[model samples]
Target: MRIKVWITSTVIATIGVAAWAHTGATGVVLERMQGMSAMGESIKTLTPMMRGQVPYDADLVRREADAMVGHSGEQMARLFPEGSGGGVSKALPSVWEDSEQFAALAEDLKTAAEGLKLSAGNGLATAQSNDSGSMMGGTTGGMMGGGASSMMGGGMMESNQVMTGEMFANMPADAAFTMVAQTCSACHQKFRKEDE
Candidate 1:
């Protein structure tokens, strides 16, 4: 009777631990999914911005910026927890050890997004009025402040202007694509799986 009771107790404890681990893993997966979705939305928002098809809508820009900033703050960390199925994640173990730096990058992204929202909120007049283009210019001094300056010439255009299509009409189509690529590279370098 004693032997059977001890075995049963051990089995129950093991199951409980497994269940707890599974729950944590599930949370991590969900967080990753949410981050991916937010990133996708941010890209979508950039489409019109890149084209300069519409005048800068401060409210719309702010909302998109808010989403991106929120994702950086809330979801980036959760996606890289230890033991989560890596799937497409490029996150490295160094993220845990160098959490402060990782978080700082995330914070920088958040700050950039916030600045974008504020700049966009003030309207196109403010953006164009300033010698430096507003957030839409893709300039280093702009909201993203030129991190991916090569992606777009550092010039602020009206929201309705469709800057890339209008200004670089003759260029190969790949210019706009680099914006997304740069973002992926930045994130993958720090958080994602390093190529073996």
Candidate 2:
């Protein structure tokens, strides 16, 4: 009787663990997915404008960049609590194990989004001056600002007026957007499962 009782208790405990893992983990997976989805939607909104397929609208870029910034940084890191990576989660083990790296990537995303917003609202020069090349892969001052100055014949790009659609279409601001996208891709490649 004692042996039978022990076996029954073991089975019950195993079932309990499974249920706990499944139910508890589902909420975290859903939350993180929702946050990521919002970021993706923002990227989709900006791409057409960057490509000149649609009219360039700085206000629209600022709005979407703000949304991207909102979804990133500490807000993003909070979505992945400890032990919340199993079950249906697309997040890999590295996200929790190498958490500092993950946090750095999140911060990088925020910086890129902020740069885009600054460029859209203030001017491309503001974004270039602020770039540290930490998130975007290269120095904006050297690559973007210098290049743009030469392209524009070395005069400061007018900061007060919204860029003409033609000027916006041809602007180096596209590089800023590209850097943000690349940062996202790098994080996904390192810490997210492809099947997910």
Could you tell me every candidate's TM-score relative to the true structure?
Answer: 0.51, 0.63
Q: Per-residue lDDT of 1-196 in model 2, one digit per residue for the tens?
A: 0000001222223223333333444476777776677777677677666665677688888898889899999999998888887666767899999999888778777866776776674334334345564332333334334333232232212123222334433334554565467567767767876541
* Per-model lDDT: 0.44, 0.59
lDDT digits (tens) for residues 20-57 of candidate 1: 33333446665665565565556565545534555655
Q: Give the TM-score of candidate 1.
A: 0.51
Candidate 1, 185: how far from true, in Å?
Answer: 4.2
Assess the local accuracy of residue 5 in candidate 2 as a C-alpha lDDT between 0 and 100. Answer: 7
Model 1 spans > 4 angstroms off: 1-25, 85-90, 122-185, 194-196
User: lDDT winner among the candidates?
Assistant: 2
Count of backbone clashes, every candidate in sequence: 15, 0
Model 2 worst lDDT run, 10 consecutive residues: 1-10
Give each prediction's root-mean-square deviation over alpha carbons: 18.3, 18.2
